[model samples]
Target: MRFIKLFCLLISCSFISPQISAQGNKNISATEKKILDQGLVDIQSVNPEILVELKYATPDNFMKKNVYGDLTHAYLQPEIAKRLSKASSLLKKAKPGYKLLVYDAARPNTAQYKLWDALDDLKIPARQKTQYVADPKIGSNHNFGCAIDLTVVDEKGNPLDMGTKYDFFGPLAYPRSEQEMLRQGKLTTKQIANRNILRMAMVHAGFTVNTTEWWHFDGMSKKQARAKYGMIK
Candidate 1:
């Protein structure tokens, strides 16, 4: 009887070990693991109020394919994460029930290559593509975990209309063109106001706005990021 009980316990242990290993591996991708290993903190860990919907983790992005498999959480460098948390707090204070919704953060260089290739396959002109997607060779602030793509969401979790959708590659999405677009009736005043709310919170938290992409913000300049931390491989 004692031998039989021991055998049963061994069998259960063997099954449980593999299950645990598989669950841990499926929780995040290798690229994400590397990002975490490099000391990037998951944004939600710093501020649970900030919502995350990583576009690359789903097919809803401009790529139209899920590039970040099993990697749903948004990560950023420690200081950048703190700034984002501050931005989240600012939004809540300013708008009562609004929240900062993150779309992407701490992208790996490997993912950058995927985006670059996707643009090439789309036959986008070199100059036009660079405006939307950074050349992987040069690296983006995202590669160093200093950039984020985000928007504002109301109390009920609905994202505010920011003129164009996230990742829209056109003049309509350009911050510099917002006034012109509003004057031309392409963007409404309410939409511009919604964008300003998000901009104010982020800027107040010490983030630099990306002029061409309203949803994108950098915690620091590319040169600063490179000097502090090299691109995440």
Candidate 2:
């Protein structure tokens, strides 16, 4: 409950972001503007073809201390959206059944999106922060709209547990982590098998999995990853 509240606060403040520091927003290409005119930056409408999986969870361990809240369900910047469409289109082609699960959309409060400070409060070590902290200096890929945090869900809309909850910060959430499941022999092999289904799909879509966060994927396109990444001025 406490985590949820802080998570909400963070999202409410951070979701309406516009590259606070100017950063590289000024360089918006004419083509990018065309995408914006069509409302790529904002949620035009939920894609009916795509399944609606679990939305952002503030109470979740990785984001529990977040004061910036969740932006996955919020409005996106047009410049970023255009690129996302390109990324998503390719992803869908690579993995037909898989869909993008956007967790953090656009941060209205980029300041509150401090992974390091949040981890420190959670008692995570300094060295570990580098591995987890969404660096504000370079900014997160989520900020650029090229990256997304996502997982698979069943036809019933229930999240297929992939070892741990989405955004869970521990080793158990690692893609290749040997850590045991949370419950003592609760979920069966079949459930885990389903979870891996999503992982395999993501890999097929040219995404590189994060060793720590199973829900995370770095989109395969080098062009997208290299360009329009940092949002801070």
Candidate 3:
């Protein structure tokens, strides 16, 4: 009877191990993985001072689901990673006690379809949704590993209040609308200043800020980005 129980346990373990391994590799396609291997680098390796929190890898994002499955690493194109490292160094030099906290980077093109489908269920107009998330056909700089969503944090890793959350899809999240938001009391002066500090560092390090999202920054112009990098599908 004991031998029979042991045999059953071993069978269960054998089946479970394969399932777990498959789950680990299922989120990213083979082609995507190969691109990542050849063209991207973990941002942490470029700047150990930067803090990485891959929101899409967990259920804490706007999707409210684990879109990145088991992959939690924040990766970027090699040049982008170097620029991010420079940005981190600039911020630290300027503040001496702050660091950049990254939220998302190097999103797969396949994942863009999931976000697009989820947005379709909402009452938002297609144009409005596109402002926040690019249509998969057009593709985002993130899909090319040339964009990043991030904020500033203090020495202790406490995030600076940027008036809105990372994925906030409203006018309040707009860097261009900060004055209007401030006038409406939706955002404070200090929050705008904090946002500017982050922008200054990234801009000086060769990144362009998006008009709609204060947290979103592109390593290059959209035209240059798409032309230079292949979309990660």
Candidate 4:
């Protein structure tokens, strides 16, 4: 009778194991599962008001390739996610119907390598390439789940005119050159105001904007991030 009871228990366990596994992964892809495993929180889960449009997940980015397969959601460190949520709130309070639109976040080092390879194929010099995509060898703040690339969007979901497209790799995209670009008629006052709105929200929420990329912001310095968390492999 004991042997029969043990046999029944084993049969039940076999039936339950696959069900549990499938349930856990029902809506999550391998890449998302990995990011969650590394302790990154999904931004939408933190603040649904903040829109996510992962450019690398599609071919709309500068690379012009879909490097982030099955990774549509943006992920960030828990603290960083909270900061992003705060930024979203601030933007809503200031602009009423405006929302923060995320372009990219918490990139895997593997994706970084793919971006590097794409630039390499284009014959872009290594030094110049670093300005756009960080070298995978050293890793980026995104790899540490401490960075975000985002913009402001109106209630209609149309992105504000920030002078250039999200991934425009040129002087027009450089925040440092915004004044010069404006003086030279390359950027309009309204464009600079739009960019400033984004900066105000993010900077007030404890993020620092990148010098070259108006859309890029760091939740913490790279050195600080490296000390706090391991890079997302």
Candidate 5:
């Protein structure tokens, strides 16, 4: 009888070991889980059709390094996710073949510092770099989970020519300067139209585009977001 009891106990331990191993190896920390559990919602849960690349997760961004590490998902505040979904839906209705392609969302504060440090160009003053990347001290709207850097992609998932590439730090990337860039032969009329399509869809869904960067959009006013949410650590 004792031998049979020992055999049963060994079988139970074998079954439980996998569960313990899985729990111990989970990627999310308690703090990150807490953040997800609260005000933030995974954009994939809200709209899986929305294409998310998360440039910082790969080495493709301006930093030229993977700052986001193993994190592959994009999370935004609940309202932000809804607004992004609405924008994508509008884009789909306007152009059945196109979809919103998110490049970055809900950036962590540490990532901001890494970006800041990467801008080691002595030619560009510290003040100017802050214009492109928010000062870590002030924090960015993305850090508050209220902003997204995105563009429109075609049926083939190729990014539409939005005049300038994502994370291009130049006046040509500015939406407000589109005409100037066009006159300079830097941006073609077709590129401008593509940008307008994205802007119109996002604006119709109540997202405000930043004048400086064509791909950047905010779900809420910066003042309101700053007052309401703490920067993601």
Candidate 6:
């Protein structure tokens, strides 16, 4: 979300402690860097690849607090940049005027703390997990600058309907909705169509969709996707 104003509350996701959160940019490794570099070289811009906007935060929902690098100016590592470079070509190949909005990129999962804050503004509930646990804090792929939260925008720069708002995390983002009425709460029929347009385009371009979050996609394959990946956090 450019600014989905979810409320602010600190809850430790797992062994992921505040001290651990302080260890910023932990997902980046040397090999990942190599992939990013070469990936960029192969990345091709769609017909009219362009950067319409680059929003960092909206006062209440900030992402740079304890993460790595500057939050105000988002980053896409190298691989992601490569993938997006291909997105333009992919979109233009599929349909003219199809564009992507890069909402969040290269943000620490701790940045998720701010993302949750925006959930309230969008009426999405935050997972009520307890303060601490024994989980390994695998860390967000964003630490490696691999993950991003965004949606398809029209040539005019308006967000298309995808049955629900980006990052909503509710039942709608599930990517398998059979409920037509459920769509009325947020997106309309035309919006959903536009959403599918983008989703389909992404799938054809070697990206994998997150079952629970339509706006969340990664270029990593099934094996590489679960390679116990970590960044420089």
Q: Compare the candidates by lDDT and give the number of the best one.
A: 4
Candidate 6: worst 10 consecutive residues by lDDT? 127-136
- Please give the RMSD to the true structure for each candidate, in Å: 5.1, 13.2, 8.0, 4.6, 5.5, 15.0
> lDDT per residue, candidate 1, 1-233, as tens digits?
99999999998777753322533434656766777778788888778888999999999988899987767788899999999999998988899999999999988888899999999777889888889999899999999999999999999999999988998978999999999998899999999999999999999999998999999999998999999997898
lDDT on C-alpha atoms for all candidate structures:
0.89, 0.51, 0.85, 0.90, 0.84, 0.51
Candidate 5: clashing pairs of residues: none
Question: After superposition, which runs of candidate 1 have C-alpha atoms over 4 Å from their true positions?
Answer: 1-29
Runs of candidate 5 exceeding 4 Å displacement: 1-34
Error of 5 at 65 (Å): 0.8
Compared to the true structure, candidate 6 yields what TM-score? Answer: 0.59
Regions more than 4 Å wrong, model 3 = 1-32
- Compose the digit string of candidate 5's lDDT tens values, residues 1-233: 99999999998777753322433434664445545755686787789889889899898988777898756778888888999999999999999989988899988888888887778653567778887988888888998999998999999989998877899988999988999989999999999999999999999999998989999999997689889887788
34-118: candidate 2 lDDT, tens digit per residue:
3343343543342334432324325444544434433223334454444444545555665555555555544322532565467
**132 Cα displacement, candidate 1 (Å):** 0.5
Q: TM-score winner among the candidates?
A: 4
Comparing 2 with 5 on TM-score, the higher-scoring candidate is: 5
Clashes of 5: 0
Model 5 TM-score, 2 decimals = 0.85
Per-prediction TM-score: 0.87, 0.59, 0.84, 0.88, 0.85, 0.59
Model 6 misplaced stretches (Cα beyond 4 Å): 1-56, 60-69, 109-136, 178-188, 221-229
Model 2 global lDDT (CA atoms, 0 to 1): 0.51
